[model samples]
Target: MIGRGSRRFGLGVLVGVLLGFAFALVGASPAAAHATLASTDPPQNQVLASAPDQITLTFTEAVRPVPARIKVIGPDRSVVNGGSPTSNGTKLVIPLGRDAGKGTYLVTFRVISADSHPIGGSFVFHVGAPSIDPPQEGEAAVTKADPAVVWALGAVRYLGYVGLVLLIGPMLFLARLWPARLSRRVPAKLVATGLGLLAFSTVAEMYLQGPYTAGTGLFGADADAIMNALGGSYGTTHTVRLGVLAAIAVLLRPFVRPQGPSTIDLAVVSFFAVVGLGTWPLSGHAGVSPAPAVSLVADAAHLASMGVWLGGLVVLVAVLLPKANARELGAILPVWSNWAMMSVIVLSLTGVAQAIIEVASFGPLFDTRYGRLVLAKVALLALVLVVAYFSRRLVLAPARKALVGAGGPADDDEELDEPPVKPLRRSILAELAITGVVLAVAAALVQTPPARSAADAPPEPYSVTLSTDLYRVRMELDPARTGGNSMHLYAYNPNGEPQTVVEWTVTATPADGSIDALDIPLLPVTADHAVAEPTFPTAGDWDIKITLRLSDIDQATVTQRVRIGD
Candidate 1:
């Protein structure tokens, strides 16, 4: 027959799952955490009277200046940028010569974000007229990062997280709750392994940063490039973390013993541990967060709590539980349970704080990728907690009862009935598995753009090529907004050749007759195309009239209706 504890555990799981679903249903969308280009002086696809002497790009956050990462190719497939690029404040400036002829100039840029992620994009602008063919020779510069680099970087991050799990939790277990009889050798090796992984990941990240930002192959990042990367915020934090790890390696020996370190030694190591934890947030999204100080502290707390809880589980399953006698486990489990409870509380609180700061509002929690990952983490954590509750209630509680009733008939009978050790081992192993997935999601979360920052990010591109019998006229409304919108028109003959537009005119009127027709100024881009910037005052269905004269003798007008939203 099932015990009272078993029934309670099952009920708790059911309730937690229901609550998780309810929360997901009511939650707003999830958001991806990524830095974006806020604006550009010569906006994408803009037409200019003459080539500007420089191109300036403004991002939502500060970024590292990697000269080789920014390339400007003119209509002739020749580099037009005159000097080294400059990164100042939130702007990246690329100088160009005034002689950058009348045609399209494609600017491709790659920069390391404030959070140490590599972001790259390309934009094109026309001077005097559109080029017959824009430079496409070095198209490699505009593509995504090398797949090997992507995999290697992700693997390194995963390794570092695993190392953190091994390093932090086992140390605490040894210092406080470990059984005296258990050998310290295994636990000590685990700590050393964790430290090694973290140190190796940090060094690898520095080397990878150069190739990542430059959009090059893995081996492409050299010593000079890596050194230049170190000069940036991401590199500095990594270097500091390496130093902390070195100190930790030296001081952690005493603490790995069953008797543990002296109070002074413990104090010193703790201080460095906290400092090292700070480096993670300082080099990541938290450092540039809206409330940087608060977010950084919360992130550090979150990391520390995760290490204690998840890492503790690892030690309990792999070493402590297996080696300890029932009496030792009865003693160790309760203390470990209390520690886990405390870690959970800290994790929950700090997680909520970081989420609030990063998510900004309820809407993004359901709407964005970051939010979805967060929800997954929350759901999995809830499941882990449910299992933990059962483990404590059925396994630890019964074991404690047996310990109290030792040498009595009731103790022997109860121990035989439950066999709590096997169940407890299984529960802890399950919890570790779930938390491992949670850590993976956490890694992804750090890479994403915060919901708050992405909430007001630029809209998706809106452009569609249209065709007609008299002449194929392509009308594009940039950003598809209600207010000011940039529009471009390209005309072609029935034979699919560029057709000269002698005269072009456009009129926009509300389809519902709420507003009168307004003229839009059309500027000639080439023999076959013209551009215009029009303002739609309100949100509604609007009709656009495009009249183009392919020749003095032949002209055609086409009307297209489109809906605009606020």
Candidate 2:
């Protein structure tokens, strides 16, 4: 009844809304891109005659700096800055070497971002003239999952996939043995349930994927950020997954049997189960390893096992209970027990593999938020296993006796009990609840980096001492930073006389290979120690190598920096 133009307008509005939601989901996380240098004043592929007065490197967003560092290679790969890096806001300044040569020089730098992400980059620039240079150790950003988050997401994603697979896979397998009992229409309905869930999850995941990949929610990212994610490998994998899932839906007819099981039924169930497993590799975890296929396989096993366990339970409650007579249920229960046990064993093995791959140590289990959640999930899983064990050992094992009204005359049957069924049903409900919580935790963990890796992390804290005739100078940098600009440095003297510092020369460079120096001022806060405000240019570990001159023979050099900046 609507006009063509009006229909078109409504369609257009729907399309726009879909696109907007899609963008918002992907646009949420600023942390998704992983901090890296966007461009520099000197430029990576560029050459210049004279060194720029200052160097500035831009990134996708604001980043925190660890000691803010930069190193001039001097065409000889030797450190040209007097001692170590210093900072000046977003610009990293390295002091020019007095006797520097005239060839192309490589700049390398590292820093930490405000978001606690590590950022590093490098560029090549010539001093005398502009000329092409082979790409220097090209700038790159490093990312690692927080251990707790890795295991958290890993556990949840697999559990959800397993539930779906178990829910549908067996209908194909079971239909062949008991045609009437399996029913003509249940397979279709089961497949439909999976398809519906998969569809909803895919849509939801796409929205959350942006935040998951971006490392923040919808409020944190911009249009360019979303566009960038779409243009990367992350986007490519998701597209392939969508295609695979769509194919599964089209080929789903085999899974929903009309009466008997066919080769098509068997093949489709396996294919869809494998499709469910596909999520792990497509997740941020897959690209992390050198062997992508191996990681994918491990993840697949984890998902397949989960599908058999959780999905089977769902099917038992929603459809199987009402349809099956006590005799049929007695037969089905034992077979399900075997399948559930096999799944539990496989799940345990794969879960360990995944945990080892993602979590380096057990400390995070208690220390990190993600780890704590993972522990909670494990406790819940244990409870599920206990329920399963009791259900199998105490209730279902005595199958002939548990049934109320068998058609055949039974001479050796024992007295039956129905109260155990109540407990079994309750346990299943609890299992489903646990699985749901696991999924939510997974959503959060996908954004965090592992806590163990050294790439973007600061070195563990230790002590350094620089001694002179008048005093012994000692400074301590925490090595592991807890939060915002909490860097502490201590100075002391052995002599009773207060040491007066006439001048302090401070120069810093960014890890991204950015700059030279700014004319900085220094004021004395104490007779022996002077307080100087340093503006770090980038994020990551910064090498703070400083020399303190008390007198001609009374000078000391101290170098220290923990993780700093964003």
Number of the predicted model whose lDDT against the real structure is largest? 1
- Taking the tens digit of each residue's C-alpha lDDT, what string does model 2 give over 140-201? 12122234433433544444454366455555345443435456466466666666655555
Cα shift from native, residue 216, model 1 (Å): 1.8
lDDT at residue 483 of model 1 (Cα atoms): 89
Per-residue CA lDDT of model 1 for 1-566, tens digit only, reads 12466556555645654454446445634333346788898988777888888999998777876777788898777787899999897899999964667777888888777777677777778886556455652662665677887777777877898999899998887777776776888888889999999999888877886776666789987776677666767888898999999999999878766687888987898999999999989988898777789999999999999899889888877876666666776677767766777787678767776876677666767777877878888888888888877766655455654233222123344334435566767878888888888887887787676776566567644554455567877676877778888888877778655778899999999998987899999999678888888999988888899998877788888888877756
Model 2 alpha-carbon miss at residue 433, Å? 2.4
lDDT of 2: 0.51
Native-vs-model 1 lDDT?
0.77
State the lDDT at 41 in candidate 1: 82
Q: What TM-score does candidate 1 get on C-alpha atoms?
A: 0.81
Q: With candidate 2 superimposed using the best TM-score fit, by how many Å does residue 274's alpha carbon deviate from the native?
A: 2.3
- lDDT per model vs. reference: 0.77, 0.51
- How well does candidate 1 score on lDDT at residue 66? 71
